[model samples]
Target: MTRTTLALALAAALALAACDRGPANGAPAAAPTAGAPQAQAGQDAAAELDALYAEFWEESLRLNPLSATYIGDSRYNDQLPDTFSAEFRQRQLDFAQRWLERVRGYDVEQLEGQARLSYEIFVSSLEEQIEGERFPGWQQPLNQFYSFPSSFAMLGSGTGAQPFRTVADYDNWLARASNIPTLFDSAMANMREGMANGVVQPRVLVEKTLPQLDGLIKDDPEQTLFWRPIAEMPEDFPEAERDRLTEAYRSLIADTLMPAYRALRRFTAEEYLPAARDSHGLDALPDGEAWYAFNVRRITTTDLTPAQIHDIGLAEVERIHGEMRQVMQEVGFEGDLQAFFEYMTTDPAFTYESEEALLADYRAFEATVDARVGELFSLTPKAAFEIRPVEAFRAQSAAGGSYMRPSEDGSRPGIFYVNTYDLPTRKTWDRDALYLHEAIPGHHFQIALQQELEGIPTFRRFGGQTAYIEGWGLYAESLGRELGVYADPYTYFGRLQAELWRAIRLVVDTGLHSKGWIREQVIQYMKDNSATSDTEAVSETERYMAIPGQALAYKVGELKIKELRARAEAALGEAFDPRAFHAEVLGDGSLPLDVLEAKIDRWIAAQS
Candidate 1:
């Protein structure tokens, strides 16, 4: 996930009515008005809210410089805050509270269309942030999944969101990256505090962090991942500047970056590991029950308790299993579900021979989808994306596939990173669903189109609800047949299996955190229930352990989206347009689930 996604990883989708740019083939959500008084009020309201949102975004960028860099803003590129510090935490809380009050001052009922939607999202997000301050997530910041070291590596390396186009860009990075060691020091201090408070990370996750740090901590700066910019410097640069950049980067990597990595590694292995808890779930810590509950609400953007979500997961899993069995019958597999899973996973034809072949096949799948995607999605993003393997250092702990949204300025294309680590686990059947979820019509479509939306605030464009984002990704996986993939029965099974994995996440995530399930038990449940390989099972289990309530988002979000679509179809009958319904869902950007449902209902009513 992108840094922005992780930062604002809560909420769902919402939009305006189709007649007034709300849904059904209308423009981006904008305030519509009639009469002189109403028009003036609308203008004043829009002006005030727009100004507030812009101010909030600008200050936010200053506070979160990495966010600016990711969105193609370079003004704050040379800064990195010690975000894990209590002082910084206070600043963030104050920021949220202050902004929440400002946005809430508006007469929200008087505001209509996108204006009201923006107000609700801004206020809700801020309120959630403030409410969540009671839980000290900053203290236990180092996880295998979303720690500073991993994100820093991506930014410093030439491949990620940080720009390397100009000589000044290189210099800005040098200045910015110099603060990393200080940040690492702060992280260690926070971890020490967490240790004292009985809030340390699971030892299993900390163990994984060690190898990740080792992969980057090289003796020679030139050998380091951070050295990529210097190595791949553009030939058009003047010799003097190139030489200057090369040495500066070398010094930066060796003196600053590598030492920071080593320090973090040593801290993790020697001091932190011994202090880390053996337990696997968030519920193991102090006030962990409330902490997990807050996460469950925040991640899923719903009041459905952990028990409710767990029951939903069980039902969905059983339903998907039945579907998978039918696919097995279609494929003429005589064995039971487990044996069919084994056949699909271990069959040579279902596995790729090489990383090169895996990437090539994904690229080919993109073309195949593009040819027919128009049939399903008239609402598409202008931004393009590419297929690449995950960086070697992070692939083991990374997801099977993930999408990085394109830059705001369009300098970078969206990236669909397919993990090739443990190549046999990178099943061929999995590619179609994964591609649909992570690339076209999934993240890149929702996120990039969100960024592309006119007349919305920057926060709405960049920040997101996890349920809305990942939910859309999972929902996109179901559109495979419409987009000319999932043709074979086994490939269709891959779609069901993918959905089944998410359903399993709901079970095991709740199981681990709320039900006192062990790490081994979670892994066992995944294997017993799905076609997940040992590698996927382990990594996914740890991911749930790392971020307690996140796994629930995919299933929860997907179910809501599916429900809305079904409602729209039933309401509109022959008049229903899937494309227009889709536009309504995405047109308003990521929203809270209730807001999305309400907005979709309006669109459905408009069509009816």
Candidate 2:
């Protein structure tokens, strides 16, 4: 799953900035004497850059406080911003530009290794953030899938990032929660600007968003999801404190939250929906083609054009389809490729009888794979994770599975949210590979380990490249056999099926955005190419639309990783070790694809 950020229009994990300086607001200081000798000066320059990173991180958290909550920092628990407001967007732009120039003011000649890596990535990330400003994302902040209404509901649900453990925690949320109405107004104002400027979201997307808002609106506080804290209130508080807090939450929900939800719901359904566009592709808006290209650069961290990525996706789809044919022949399927796809998706024998059974089976995969992790990985996270059903509120549009990072303080474990929305549609053959991708050696391992690395600045720990992050997840699926769970031919086919699905994404995501393929065309392409159900095809297609160019990352990333590994194996045949290669790939956390390739090449040379 892609990491969620409260950066509003900013790419969140993919965007932030850094510079030269000492630490700020309690972070470790890294500074050098101004006139030190050359060797010492370089070391000090690197150290000072680290100091800048720490300070940037501190200031960034304060600016986007909800990010702190998501990353498991509690100090900003009481903060939330109206990110949709014009003022906030301008301030964010200034923040990006200020740091971009600050970072460029430093000398890169005085840095090397990870310190240099941090500097280069930090500057690129901030530049992307500033370049992204030309695209009016704040005007269309609400996607059918990730609208603030639903995400805010999740935060208020007492089970999300907003902590509800202590009375102080509850109070923090209350203070933050009370700001919802103002934020809602700001969002509405932004949408109004979008309508005037012909930059509105598609009508179909807005239609989907309406139901999500409907779920959040309730006249009575007790009937709303906001009452979750009250229902699950901590037991330790004194009677008077409990009574007072309970009434306060009730009033907060009824007075502040419900009205906001109701207003947003009405404004969206009645006012905004009518004004939303009929066109779907970003190419339809003014400067839309360039806007999408900008998003592509920001998302993938690469210069690859739509045509190049489209061709790459096509080649991958064709190659994976040939592999699927082999799986069909091995399984002794009677008919053609489409028939085999139908069989894999439709066969009842490949499904669980109940949700409990499905969840229990996934829980069993942990031990099964853990036994063989030693074969491929020398690095493992100390952070624990558990499997959970996708919450009902967002499961319909959520991915088959997603991983939320663990809390830094060990207060919350990383969560693997498996979507059980339609259990039968979730095939038994699908689970093992999905397990590898989302939980085991996929997101959980990569993300948690990145967070756990020693002496890295907060930006490196938390920032990510989608190509590296999701690419690693897809690459991990290829390790199913190594992890000892795909001995069965059908299960191995599941691994191939997962790979095929990602390969298909490259074709369809580009088709919808750049090639003018309609939603139906994308869905039909998916049905023809992969084992995913119609439900999954439709959901995945819309997901690509919601976040254009994002689907391209998986295949582009996986191909680069696989290519690098092949080069390493060929170059250092006698000395090549899979475990060492993996450790090296994951050693410095998520990186841009080119940077990853260079790092692996360096390791191969060292081995020889």
Candidate 3:
């Protein structure tokens, strides 16, 4: 997912409706009024901004209960309102519009620094949500990559963000789980509408989703993934509560969750699969080109068209391929670019002996990189992080690594899940760059530090821009050399491989949505361009298929950051300080690429 949707969708799914009293660091939450005296204005404005922010956050959670859950709030856990319903969807749109209007009326000039920027970001995001209603995203929600079936399997496995330790927890899920049948029925209806309207997913993607749903359907309640809560009910619960919750959960699983999954599975396999499109491009659907364009703007936060992004991707691919060729020469590989890719993939020396060794290697890189963080960054996060394998149920289709943000209360550490599904694809060469991007100095550092900022309003602290966030992640991959991993030629090749993967994403993501590339064609392009194994290639291709413009973020955002950085270094000549430059880039949290560039220009002018 692009950082916007990653944050916004997660916010939609996970943020809760709790009142924000203030900053978690003990600051009082309130914002100052306008036209106060200059001397006292700063303090008053800070307080006023805090109150406005707290209201915004509370309203946000209420509007998007799923977000509240992910942030660790239990207030709406038992309430699974039909988020896909037209009424609820309109309510969400109205919520965004009202909040945008309310916050805009507040005299932001009274606020200073981070608070002002936070206001802009909040307004921009809400406005973007309102604008995005034109696209029919709800019609095509369940894809192979991240449909509710797979998400629930991960949660019901007793290992995800969903908690099952209390009777309340069990009851919450029971209430939530009971709604699955309705959602499934709605999904089948929506897919029918899509098929009639010619907006169906590619046949290949629909085919892959059937098995995922089938795996979740069970004849017996105890055999179902959803039955885990009943199996592990807390011993301390009152007997009445335990007995009541256990029976309710069992019935919910047997009569509700499983049947819904089975029905959806059968419908996809028997009905939708036959009607699914052979064409891959979103542009082929009704208003598909416009939808793809909207996604591009939402993801990149720029007006650049699909064709523009396509050209940029082509240039980056060529540049990175040249670097890989140099790496081939360094390793004394005898043939062309594809030959070197083969050598890297087949070489036994680059493979991990076991999953334990793989995890150990990543942990070791974390320690090594942590030691050097102070050299580059002036700010750091208080939240801790851990490296874990992607949960097995979804790992087959998961990415190499991804970060889950920390709980608002810090009860849970941020998790960086690395998928080790196919051992050879999980190469030692890939680990260093992956570690930097998903862990230490990449997502965990950027997202967690933003969450920990004290004076910024809660929304700003929590909010993100995809370009800035993913741009930072891609930039983090470049730090492998300074962080000490790229000294080895093979490891350096890994960094290039990672970059190449992203570059290929730029090509294929646009190619699928705009240029009419078929599913196999996209998969073929990925396999030809990088050393990713067949399993990894399939997963990555499906990910791009699932989210139309998301994969564009990594390369698009990275290119903008790198371009700006080069400009800054050249303009400053001998006076440039990487540490200070990084501080400026990160200190304000995430911003649009244009906004980021403008801010950097101001910083450069001030330094000069």
Candidate 4:
């Protein structure tokens, strides 16, 4: 799941949530699994693969410092890669090419079970990275859903990954912060290139970014989020040093960061916004169809065509609507499904009394779900998690709830950020399903476990495939009933509504990108089929517009996991265990849907 989502949708609706277990899959409870023979030659091959992975990780960290900071690796805290630069893009291309060749030198067939799996995944990822170079992702760098400026504010706010524990940490951020001007310039240049190539973002999406930039650029440095570190500076620091740092930060914010933000804000408002495409679909641009197709392939990790996915979405929407009808009957609502949807969306009882009540309710879910988590999950992460609100600055566009993967060192607990901005709109009915999807036994459970894995390579541990990750979150939501949730009919309806939203995304995302659907069409689709508020519909549609083929992951991944579970239950009969099946699906970390399917098949065969 990414850091953001539509407020109507669960946060981290598209992120890393895995359910791994078994010694073969790096679970502590399982014995050492060696599917390869004890032949010396085979052992050497496996050892070599491990060595390659280690070296690759080391080099990768050096190249991508932001990734290092993200995982709580402070070694590169001072660095910020110029991610939008042509040089950086070329470097990425070169790294993939070199690694692809280096990895191919080893024979995957000669490797044992886990080693073979790692080798295969690494090879496939590198190949995809190489293949992906054809698409001009660098041209379309900024989206309200995912942008550098907002992320920069989070990093420098002293609350995100940039540790503010020591004096060195302060200095490290200063070094990192100094690069903002360069990054913004790079972005401006890239957007210009995008305009030239007819690859510019839709005008509506560009408009959403203006308010985000406005929030970042404040008149007084002390009033800015960048000043937060100084405000919360460690008391233990020598007064003289603290004083010196405070003055330095004041200058940095006013002189450097402000100008950078203003320059970008001005460019965006004056030039880029006007140049942005009026058309909504990716099909409007040159090679837009192919670009979207590549994205669909990367996102779903499947070769299913757009038409196939669109058809799948339509079927799923119909099915979920039928389930919603069941909920309507259970709730004894006098109206039709649409009327009930309108009632649920508009009802005052469904909303929290205040933001405090909203956050408190979300926090309370931890203990509630904790009591039942063990019934379905045999293993849980050692790294704990906490519930927090989405920062006010971005909350307008933020998802209902999102999960941040824990730091590898366990110092940074996974954060489940619930949006408390639009308090009245943040429905109580959504709380349970949102929690299950983004918190315990969902994003938090799957993503943290994947990071904490011992034997898996860093790529599989830290990197993720969207479909499997999001699918697991969606699948985890289905467990609410068995986990003692969805007990109330309205609550159960919320779960179905959540599922329906995802299915709708499958339709709308494909519709917007490939099937000639406009923004209004997508919004109307949500209003008709689900309990999505107008604000949620608009933002959610914009989110799909911003990132094509991404929203499809939730339903596609969930469907696959559910399909696997059903297959296991039917095949093994009395031998079927939900917990074990979950562990198997998540055990290998995130995989391409086909690879995940193959792995699940292997587990099913073993069970048989």
After superposition on all C-alphas, the RMSD of every candidate to the true structure, in Å, is: 5.2, 2.7, 4.3, 5.4
Query: In order, what lDDT does every prediction score?
Result: 0.82, 0.81, 0.76, 0.81
lDDT digits (tens) for residues 145-232 of candidate 3: 7667776666665656677877767777777767767766776887788788777888878888876776677788888777777788
lDDT of 2 by residue, 134-221 (tens): 8876688778666677777878887677899888998998899889899889888988998999988877788888777777788788
lDDT of 1: 0.82
What tens digits encode model 4's per-residue C-alpha lDDT throughout 197-264? 88898999889989998998899999999999999998999999999899999999999999999999
Error of 3 at 321 (Å): 1.5
**Candidate 2 overall lDDT versus native:** 0.81
Alpha-carbon deviation at 21 in model 4, angstroms:
26
Best by TM-score: 2
Q: What 10-residue stretch in candidate 3 is worst by lDDT?
A: 10-19
Which lDDT value does model 4 have at 514?
92
Model 3 vs. true fold: TM: 0.90
139: Cα error in model 1, Å: 1.1
Which of the two, 2 or 3, has more lDDT? 2
Cα deviation in Å at residue 316, candidate 1?
0.5
Which rank order by lDDT, best down to worst? 1, 2, 4, 3
Q: For model 2, which pairs clash?
A: none
Which is the winner by TM-score between candidate 3 and candidate 4? 4
